[model samples]
Target: MSGIKRTMIILPATLVYFLVMLDSSIISTAIPQITDEFNSLLDVGWYGSAYQLASSAFVPLAGKIYIFFPIKWSFIVFFTVFELGSALCGAAQSSPMLIVGRAIAGLGASGLMNGILTILAAILPPHKLPRVMGLNVALGQVGLACGPLIGGALTEYATWRWCFYINLPVGALVGALLLSLRIPEINTKPPAYEVLHTAMSSMDLFGLVLLWPSAIMFFLALQWGGNQYAWNSAMVIGLFVGAAITSGLFLTWEYHYGDNALLPFSMLRNRVIYSASATMFFFMGVMLTAYYYLPIYFQAVKGDSPLMSGVHILPSIISQVLVTMSTGTLIQRVGYYLPNVLTGTALASIAYGLYSTFSPSTSVGKWIGYQIIGGAGSGATSPGSYIAIQNSVPRAAIPTAMAILILCQNLGSAIFLTVAQSIFSNSLQNHLRTQAPGVDVQAVIQGGARMLRPLVPAQELPSVLQAYSRAIDAVMYLGAGLGVAAFGCAWGLGFKDIRKKGEEGK
Candidate 1:
């Protein structure tokens, strides 16, 4: 492929990725309005989780589709379906409908993201992979970074409805661009489901069954533990037990059934894949705490409108975009990921550490600086994990590793979000008790944000708001601690350059 063609292919793929990520973060700014329109706090978490859950649930399926069909057709079909989902989300009238729309959109997004990586792996030369992949990561972050600002602006000026509506034009443009690109058409007739059946003769179906449900249970436990039920509630206990049993069964099945499994036992034993994924787990956990809680902090503590909250998050997003692009080029030049990962994590840790110190009185300059540091850390960490894993594994195994990496990342997000949510809510409750003395805890909890709106006379509202702000800051501190843990893991990866110029030419 000529340089011009490579650029053409990469640009559209990157834009597709950017739109998907943008939708993810963009919706955060509109959440307050979404909740009010639907009048469902219980379903609020679902808005984010719905999209993620759908994308995550079917990630493994993308590989199957790719293997069985032509890549170009698969991309076209998936992208079209995803855009349809986004359109439905914009038009949704009820919470369930919205969740359904998000899930549909996620289905499409899963393919777009995974497909982009697959195409990149096929097109980019090995030595240039890291740089190009970094660019991809940066573009994706651009969506994530600008999502809030764009979503906020649109929601504030037009309507919250436009948050979803905006995807229509953007998605259309991306689709048009992708249509113009002429990519290689894979012609292999995948050995029939007959081969899969033959392969499955030795495969572990039990592990397959256990893996997804176990993940779902565990994720649900994380999402629901603090929010819906008390930490010690029977529901929480049941969820944990279910996750543990299913996970145990999955391992047991994999060990006994042996040969062909959803996740080969051998892959797990690879120190590089395991350790890198572990780092991602912690990294994603910290990243997710920010995604889930930052908006809450903006609205509840900062007294910023939801739209403004999204705008405030723009610094973090923008920093990630700029640094991630640079990271790709840097890694390609250095031929190792350790320094970038380590430096990135350390910066993130500091950002989080500094965040722990946040109070209502914190200056905007200080917050923006911290966001930039944190964003850069995330940007650096993001590409290295995938690139390291991709570089380490055989090309054939890339899809499996990619799926596993994505699974781990999303699962970690679900688990950590739960942890942070518990901390935030508990801290808020504790502060309320100390400050108001005789106020009804149930009333405060039940009222959500609305209770404080008018019930607290104007004179005492500042103290109430202060307490909420302190609680949010405390959660951010906890997130910082998690970042430190992730940094340690990244540092331990021990830089190893895996790319070879000779490999790409084959």
Candidate 2:
């Protein structure tokens, strides 16, 4: 392919990735409005989790789809599925319908993101991969941060349904661009009919089938462990046990299937693929805490409007965008990824540690500086892992490798979000009970994170605000811990010069 063609493929791949990530966390800002419209908070958790659950469960199968099918048509199909889900979400009259839409979107999202990197791996030369991937990661990270900001703006200025509606035009443009181009397939497989005929054997359909439910079970165990059921309760324990047994079975099946397994044992044994994925797992956990909680800090603790709360997050997002682009360039030049991963995690750890000290009266300069540091951390960390995987794996297996990385990242997000939610709720309730004994803890919890002044008695409102601030502060610790964990995982990512080309895997 020529430069123009590569540019065309790269641009839309990044755009669709941004769209996919935006949908993942953007719901946070719109949830308040959505609940009000639906007149129920009972289904609130599923709005986000359903998308996450479906995405995580089917990601490996997504990789399998890319491997078995032609890249161009497969990508278009995924984009169409995602757009249909967005339409359903935008038109939803009830909460269940919205949850179903999110799940559908998630199913499509699984393919969309994996396809982005896999396509890039197919088209880009090894040396050029890092910088282009850096741009993609930067934009994608910007999309992640901007999700809340954009969601806040749309929800405050228009109906929250517009959050989902926005995906339509953007996705359409992306689909059109993709449809216009003929994407290169890295390998020439047998004809499409023969490929489909033998898909059950080559696709490892049973392994794929077992993996989705396995992921769902693991996520459910986390989601309901301490909240819906006691950790020791039979329901929670049974879920955990089932997840473990099924996971073991999945592994056994993969080992038996060897090179053709959904998660090939040959790749699993690689230091770079497994270690980079480990870093991504914890790295995403840290990144997501910001997407999920910072809005609450601005709205509930500082009494900022949703729109203003979005604005307050700009420092971090902007910083991340710049650093992401820079980091990619630097990694490409230096040919080493470990340093960026280490440095990024360290800065993020310190930034979140500083964030944990935030209070209502905290100086503006303090928060701004902390967010800049956090953004730098995120931008630097984002591209290196994918680059490492690209460098370590052959062109043909990039899809499978990228799929594994995404699975770990999303699984980490799911687990950490559950942990953060548990911590935030418990801490909020506990602090309210202790400091504002007369206030209604349940009512404040249900009120959502906005306009707290009118909800509480004047004498007790300060205490309520303080409680909210501390609860958000508490979740910052989880971010800090995840950053530290990522740093530790970096040690396992050997110092390899990606400038040295990788296997052909032929």
How much lDDT does each candidate structure score?
Answer: 0.73, 0.83
Which stretches of candidate 1 lie above 4 Å from their native place? Answer: 42-44, 176-182, 185-208, 256-259, 437-455, 498-506
State the lDDT at 298 in candidate 2: 83
lDDT of 2 at 389: 86
Q: Which candidate gets the maximum TM-score versus the true structure? A: 2
Name the 10 consecutive residues with the lowest summed lDDT in model 2: 497-506
Per-residue lDDT of candidate 1, residues 1-506 (tens digit): 75899888888888888888887777777766666666654455567766777777666566545555556677888899898998899899998999899889988876777788777776765566777788888888777777777876877788877888888888788788888878764335455565466544433444556777877787677667666787689998898899899889877876665435655668777777777877887787776567656766676667677667877887888888888888888887777888888888788888888887777688999988988888888887888887887677766566666766665665565456556656666777788788866566555555554345545667667777777777778878877877777777776566676555424544
Q: Superpose all Cα atoms of candidate 2 onto the true structure and report the RMSD in Å to 1 decimal.
A: 2.4
Q: What TM-score should be assigned to candidate 2?
A: 0.94
Q: lDDT value for candidate 1?
A: 0.73
TM-score list, all predictions: 0.89, 0.94
Summed over model 2, clashes come to: 0
Question: How close to the true structure is residue 315 of candidate 2, measured as C-alpha lDDT?
Answer: 92
Q: Could you tell me how far off, in angstroms, the CA of residue 387 lies in candidate 1 after the best superposition?
A: 1.8
